[model samples]
Target: MSPALASALAAELTRRADEDRELMRQAETIPPPDHRRRIAQCHRDNAEALATIVRRHGWPTAALVGAPASTAALMILLHAPDPGFRRDGRDLIAQAVAEGHCPAIHLAYITDHCAVDEGQPQLYGTRIDPKTLRPYPIRQPRDVDERRREVGLGPLQEQLEALGIRV
Candidate 1:
C-alpha cells in the first residue's frame, strides 16, 4: 500500500475504535435489557458493514476480532459452519485465504470491557485456526497480519506459484 493509503487506513482505524468505544460507553449508561440489545445490534451492524466492504474488495477471507455476533454472521454468509456446530475456525480462515480473499479480524473494545467488567474477553481478537480448528486470540492487527503472512499468505503464494500465478 502507498504511504498515503496506509496513513488513511490508520486514520480510519483510529476513528472506528473511537466510535465503538463511545458507543459502548453510551450503552453502558443505559438501563439493562435494552443496553445489551443495543450493543448487540451495533456490533451486528458493524460486522455486516465490514463484510460488505470485504466482499466489495473481492477478498475471500475476513477475521472478526472483537465482534462475535458480526463474525458469526460472516461465517454464516460464507457458508462456514457455525461455531456451535463443531466447525473449525482456523480451517475457515485458511480456506478463505487460499481463495485469495482478504480475511478480516475484528478487535472491538467491548472485549476489553467484558474482560474488566465481566472477567473475560467478550469477543475481541478471537480467531479460528484453519489448520487446527481451534480458537486463538489475535491481540493486535499486526499479529493477524503477521500470522496471515506466515501461514495463510505464504502457503497460498506457494500454491499460486506452482500454478504460475506470479508477477
Candidate 2:
C-alpha cells in the first residue's frame, strides 16, 4: 500500500471513531427514535465509504492499511445495517484471517453478527443480547467457549462478567 493511501485511511478511520464516540456520548440525551436514526445514518454512510475502499483495496488487511485502520474497517462493516453487505464483508474478513492478514477476533465477531442477522445460531458466542445481558444463542452452547478460545476470545461467561453482567 502506498504511504499516502495508508495515511488517508488512517485519517478517515480517526474521523469515523470521533464521530461515533460523539454520537454515543449524546445517545441518552437524544430521543430514542432520533438517536436510532442518527446511529443508522452514520453506519450507512460509513459502510458506503468503506465499500468504496473495499472495492479499491480489498479487505484492507493490517499489513496493507496498518492495524488500527484495518480494525476500524472491520468495525464499519460490523455496524452495517444491510445483512447482505455485512455477510459479504464477513467473507472477505474470513479469507483475510485465514491468510493471516486480519485478526481472528474480527472473524469471530462478524461471524456471530451475520449468523444472528440470519436467524441462525452463532458459531461463536461473541454477541450478547443487551436486554438479557447474555449471549444471543450459540450453535452448541457446550462448545462455544472452545470455539471462542480458538478465535482469541475469552469464555462467554467471563466476557459477560467483564461487562458487569454478573453472569
Candidate 3:
C-alpha cells in the first residue's frame, strides 16, 4: 500500500462524505426532483472515482486503505447506479471478507443491497423501505436474524428500532 495512494483515497472519501452531509442538509429545502438529481450526480461521480481506484488497487481493503476509507469505498460502489458494478464490488468485498481482510458486516450490507438493486428479496434484511420504515422483502424472513448474526449484524428488527422505526 503506497502511502500516497492511501492518502489520496482518504481525501476523496472525506470529500465525498462532506458532500453527502451537505446534500442531506439541503434535502428538505431543495425541490425533490432537484435533490434527487444532485444525489444521482454525486453517486455517479463517486462511483467513477472509486471504479478507477479499484481498477488500479483492487478492493481497497482495510489493509490497503485503512478501515474508514475502505468502508467509504464500499459505500461509493453501493450508491452507484449500475447493478452490475455494485455486484462486482460486492463480489470483491466478499472475496476480501473470506480472506479476513474485510468485515462480514460489510459483506452483509452489500449482499442485501445488491439483492434489492436487482429486485430480489434480500438475504439479510439490510435494505429498508424508506417510505414504510421497514425492511424490504426478505427471502427467508424466519432465518434473517440467524443470517445476520452469522455476518456480525444484529437482528433486523433491532436495527429498525434503533432507527426509531417500530417493528
Task: Report the poorest 10 consecutive residues by lDDT, candidate 2.
Answer: 13-22
TM-score of 2: 0.94
TM-score to native of every candidate shown? 0.33, 0.94, 0.93
Please provide the root mean square deviation of candidate 1 (C-alpha atoms, Å).
Answer: 15.0
Q: Ten consecutive residues with minimal summed lDDT in candidate 3?
A: 12-21
In the predicted model 2, the residue pairs found to clash are none
Instruction: Show how many residue pairs clash in every candidate, following the order shown.
Output: 22, 0, 0
lDDT by residue (tens digit), candidate 2, 1-167: 78998889877965785687688899889999999999889998988888888898888788788888888888888887888999999999989999999999999999999999988999988888888878887898999889889999998888888888886
Q: What C-alpha lDDT values do all the predictions have?
A: 0.40, 0.87, 0.87
- By the TM-score metric, which is better: model 2 or model 3? 2
lDDT tens readout by residue for model 1, 69-151 = 33433433322122221123334444555564433331122222223233342233333335554333334534543544543
Error at 131, model 1, angstroms: 30
Q: Who is ahead in lDDT, 1 or 3?
A: 3
- How far out, in Å, is residue 34 in model 2? 2.4
